[model samples]
Target chain A: MPVITYRQALNDALAEELERDGNVFLMGEEVAEYNGAYKITEGLWKRFGDKRVIDTPISEAGFIGLGVGAAMMGLRPVMELMFWSFAYVAYDQIINNAGCVRYMSGGLINCPLVIRGPANGGTNVGATHSHTPENFLANTPGLKVVCPATPADAKGLMKAAIRDNDPVCVMENTLLYGDQGEVPEGDYVIPIGVADVKREGTDVSLIAHGRAVLTCLAAAHRLHEEFNISAEVVDLRSIRPLDEQTVLDSVRKTHRAVLVDENKPFCGVSSQIATMIQEHAFDDLDAPVQRVCSLDAPAIYSPALETQQLPTADRIIQKVLAIS
Target chain B: MSVTRAEKPKKTGKNPVDYAKAPINADLTPEQKLGFLADMLRIRRFEQASLKLYQQGKMGGFLHLYIGQESVAVGTLALMGENDHAITAYRDHGHALVVGMSMNECMAELLGKATGCSKGKGGSMHFFAPDKNFWGGHGIVAGQTPLGLGIAFALKYKGLKGCCLTYLGDGAVNQGVFHESLNIAALWDVPVVYIIENNQYSMGTSLARSSAIKSCLAERATGYDMDWDIVNGENLYEVRAKTWDAMQRAHEKCRPAILEIDTYRYYGHSVADANAKKYRKPEEIEFYKQNHDPITLWENRLKEEGIADEAVIKKLDDAAKKEAAASVQFAEDSPFPELESVFDDIYYEVDMGTESGKTGRHFFND
Candidate 1:
């Protein structure tokens, strides 16, 4: 295993998959020649040539729907959006076509497509540019949504989503792109819908996904060092095919839970997890399931306000203290 | 810098370009000619029967009947090679039938029976036959535009000589996605023919009120530098000839084009469109039925061309009526989908029993 940035891990995964399967191609804005807006697809266009790494006009609706159509025709298409927020213009393509085509076609058609982009709000980009739509995407039954909190998970999940025979949406964080972690080189896939317990604990469970997982890990460390609360950190890597058993098992052992997410509070991912906890693990809980979500408002444009708006370790720790 | 003046689109009357102008139908054998007539008759009968069932309350949901525009699908689809693909919007029963979907499955789909093409899932608005290179009957207005472009992109990607017939209505041309699709189609030279089934009205809004055009809907292709033509769709031969040229440009040159098929609908946009009769004059509807009926026009052509006698025309029509009636009976006899099937077809992995499917709880209740 070698330490690598989350961006490099994703780039490696994309390059390896493109090399492994001739059908796999990358198509998006500035993916080729420009080497991607974020450079995640750096060197892919040069390595795979124009056919394999296609560049498109800034038409999210056109390219995304094209990817769905290509996938329907048995060619795997990896569509990239500069930002996940831009996907709003292409909602009909994402939700109606890519998400519902398989069900609409009654299993006669499958869109083996992967739509990946940075879907975070901490970059101080305005509300329109920064949208965390993992919950919105996961709400559709046919779509598979993943959030890679670590470099290893980013690499493995990208590989898995590319190989999977369904449309998978990989929600990456621009803030976490530079974060480094141990990622094994070559082909390996962390199966979708699996949770990784980042750290083991006994007193309370701090569950989260995406960048909030890192916040939970930091809070878990501080709690053990300062508050003497041994907090367990659970990273829900996949959102749709959620690893419910792992979540419940961790909650059962800890006897308390605090759900953390970057999504807004109303009908958010944490809200769903809280309901799941209350419904299934009611007896196992020593205290009610609590949530530390992004403030219930549009993403703030001010850097400082946006930082406070998102779930921080301090917020997670406060929620943990209240529950523990 | 000197700027070149934009070329104006050719202005034409209700019958713009005639079947006599193209004459691609000259090579067709009498049997093939009769087959075209038969195809139009099948669609007309199918739509007529479905409307009756929808009226009877046996079929629920919006039924977008393809009554008057039979020749557009039957004629244009006749030119498709094995590599050619077709996708259309909600008025899709015509394209589905033209591309070889059985009336039984389509009728069952309408009636929400398990034996339907989409296993009772997609109702009347969504029908698909991938094997026939018929991608789908997309429900969204111009949502299928890009998918059609993608199909062409895949064909060119695989080094195959194929093109996609992406059909949209005049109303769909106004959608942002269609313009985006047009831009990409021109930029990439994807083999896609955007066939605008300009049946005058989109829902209750007439074309004049819905779309602002210089000459025809296809004239919008000028902005994208794509080739385009307007064709009178009432004549099956005219549609076949003009569409054949566009499809050739796509298949041979890997170029995109827009072909506006001037046609009309006898009924409302959908069965639920309560003001279908109120929005348009009864005289206008009667005028179309009396003069511009696609099936009637094709049948007259078949007889005038010495391809089929009156008896043969009657036989083909009778057979079509029988097939449509039998499809209704089959739909009535078919069972509804199992309750558990509601969870099926949501994911390819889950249905195929992949490792991801076996390991996790995909459905919420599960």
Candidate 2:
């Protein structure tokens, strides 16, 4: 194991996959000569050369659709949306062309495409650039959505998405780009639909994903030190092919649950998780499942207001206290 | 059979210029020319049968007929190599038939039968034959343009000397995605030929009302620095002449081109368009039917070139009619897809029972 930043982990996974498969190529804006908009693809262009690592014009709709077409033709294309919010211009291509191609073609076509980029709001990029669309993308049946909360999950999930035979969307966080964690050396891949219990506890379960996972971990530590509430932190690494069993097991053990997420409160991923908990594990609960989500407003530009807008350790602790 | 125009022959999308005198490929054999006629007739006859069934309530959803634009598909697809591909908008029966989809599968698909090309998931507007290099019958206008560009990008990536002929309609040219596709195709020099089948009307709106351009729709390609031209889609020989040249530039130089084939549609935009005849006059439809009908033009050319006679043409038409009729019977005999199949094909890993599929529940209900 080696300690590395999430950015380095993602770059290493991409470089390894590019060397492993000839059909796997990277295409996006500023991914080649500019390294990357976020610098996640720093040295891939010089390593894989211009042919394998392609730089697309500022045409999200065109390039995303092109990636779907190429994937249908048996080439695995990892398309980068400079900002996940920019995906709105290409929403039709993502939802219809990439999501429905396989189902529409009735097993004759396979869109083995991966659309990955930073989808977070903590950087004060304004309301437009900050969008957590994991819920929106996972709503489509043909698409697989994942949000890696750590450096290890980032590397493993990126590799798995590239190897999957279906369209997978990797939702990354810019806030956690420089965060350091242990990453396995080689050929490591996390399955598309699995959850990781970040810490084990007995009193209550704190469920979260992406940056919210870190928030839950911080909340868990404070809850243990101050309130003596042993909070189990469940990191939902994959969203679509959701690991219901793991989530249900954690709730069934802890008996109380609090969901933390950066997505908006209305009809967010937590809404689905709450319904699932109430329906399947209602009898196992000692209290009602509570949620701490981003306020139902657009991501504000003000740094002070924006930090309060997203889920934080204080918010998670408060939600856990109410539930436990 | 000629009728005089009441006005100065309304400035419609149809180009009155005739390129039939343009020389076709020298290597094109007489049998190949006859095959072209057969392919066009097959599409026309298949569409006629599908329309009759649609009117009879045998099919569900929409049916967009490709009755008058047969030559655009046949002549262009006739020039495709083993690696070349074709994709089009919702009006896709012509491209599907030209790309070797069996009439039985296509008809059954329209009828929502299990034996259909898409196993009854995709109806008339979503036929696909990846084995034959036909990408799809995309529903959204201009949605397939970028997909076609990507297919060409893949071919170039694999070092294959082939091009993708991306087809869109007059209405589709107004969509923003089509422009985006054109810019990328030219910027990357991907081997793609965007064939704008300008059928005069975009649903109820005419091209003159929907698209604003100086001379022709393909002229917009100049903005992207891409080579482009307009060809008469009525004459099969001329369609081949122009499309052949564009295909060559794509294959040899790996460049992109735009060929706007001046064509017309005889029926409404779809079967559901109740005012198909109300928007346009009867004289306008009759004029194109008599003078520029793709089938009639190709049959006349075959006779003039001594490639076929009246009897030969009648025999080909009879066989096509018979084939279309048999397809109807096959569709009638087919079964609807099973309810469980509704969950199928959503994910390849789920169907294959791979590690990811077996580990967790793909469907939410599970």
Q: Give the best candidate by DockQ.
A: 1
Model 2 clashing-pair count:
0
- For the second chain, the TM-scores of the candidates in order are 0.94, 0.94
Model 2 chain A scores worst on lDDT over the 10 consecutive residues at: A315-324
In model 1, pairs of residues that clash are none
Candidate 2 docking band = high
Q: List the residue pairs that clash in candidate 2.
A: none
lDDT against the true structure, each candidate: 0.90, 0.91
Misplaced by over 4 Å in model 1 are B1-23
Instruction: Specify the highest-lDDT model's number.
Output: 2
* Residues A1-324 of candidate 2: C-alpha lDDT, one tens digit per residue: 899999999999999999999999999999999999999999999989999999998999999999998999999999999889999999999999999988888889989999999999988989999999989998999999999999999999999999999999999989999999999997999998899999999999999889999999999999999999999999999998998999999999999999998999888999989999998999999999999999899999999999999998998888788876
Which DockQ values do the candidates obtain, in the order shown?
0.82, 0.81
Model 2 alpha-carbon miss at residue A169, Å: 0.5
